[model samples]
Target: MNNIITIRFSALLILLVAALVTACKKGDNNALTPDLGTRVAGKYTYSELKTGGKTYPASDTNLKGTITLTRQTPTTVAIQLAIVHKATNEAFADDAAEDVDVVEAASGTIELHYNGDTIAKINGSKISIEGEDDAGTVFTLFATK
Candidate 1:
C-alpha cells in the first residue's frame, strides 16, 4: 500500500509540472508572435533627407517615396526605396535592393544593421532609421505602415 501511494504521488507531481510548463509557454509573447524582421515586412511611407540637408516627405506632393521590406532569410531582410518625381510623375530614385541583418528582436523591439549603419529600429509599427550621406551629413528617417 505504501509503495502504491508513493507511485501515485510521483505521477501526479509530474503531471502537475507538465501542465504548469504548458500554461507558461502559452503566455510567452516571444513564442506567440513571429520574429521582428518578419513582422516588419510591409510597405512604409517615409521621410528622408535629401542632399544639402533638405527633408522630403513621402506625400503626394514633393518627392514621394515608399520603402518596401521583404524577408530574405531568417535573419536578413531586403530593403528597397522607391521615389517618384512629383512634377514629371516619373521614378526619381529606385535603387537596388539592399540586405540588412537583424541585430535584435526582443520584447517588441527590433533593430537592424546594414554595412555597419544603423538601418532601422522598430517598435510595433513605427520605425526609425539613421544613416550618413556621401557628403558626411547625418540623416534620420521615420516611417509607418
Candidate 2:
C-alpha cells in the first residue's frame, strides 16, 4: 500500500510538471495582447478567383475596407470589417454582403463569416483564403493585412 501511494504521488507530480510546461509554452496566447491595430490594419491584394476552371479577377487588387479588431480575451480576437462595394458582376446566395465578421486568434488564422452567412477560412501570414467568395466565384485571397 505504501509503495502504491508513492507511485501515485510521483505520477501526479509528473503530470503537474507537464501541465506547467505546456502552459508556459503557450504563455503569449494566454496574455490576451492583441497586435497593434495599425500593424494588422491594411488592405491585402488578392490575385486569383476561380470557379470551375475559369478564374475571375478582382475588380481591384486592393480590397478597400476598414477593419476593427479587439482582443476580447486571451487567444481570441474579434474583428469587424467594413468592405466597400466593388459593383463587380457576381452572384451569391442572396444577402449581398453589407459587412463581414471575422475572428482571429493568436494563431494568426482568421475565419470570416460574410453577412452572417458563409464562412471562409483563411490562413498564413500572406492571408490566403480558400473558399467561395460572396459572389459564388471561388476566391483565394492572397492579400495581407
TM-scores for all predictions: 0.58, 0.33
Off by over 4 Å in 2: 1-29, 32-40, 54-99, 104-109, 126-142
Highest TM-score against the true fold, candidate: 1
lDDT of each: 0.71, 0.49
Model 1: residue 58 alpha-carbon error in angstroms:
4.4
For candidate 2, lDDT tens digit of each residue in 1-145? 9999999999999999999988875355734754433234344444444456765555534343433444433323345434444465332222223234555656766665555543544555344444566566665434444
Report how far residue 42 has shifted in candidate 2, in Å. 2.3
Q: On a 0 to 100 scale, what is the lDDT of residue 98 in model 1? A: 56
Candidate 2 accuracy as lDDT: 0.49
TM-score of 1: 0.58
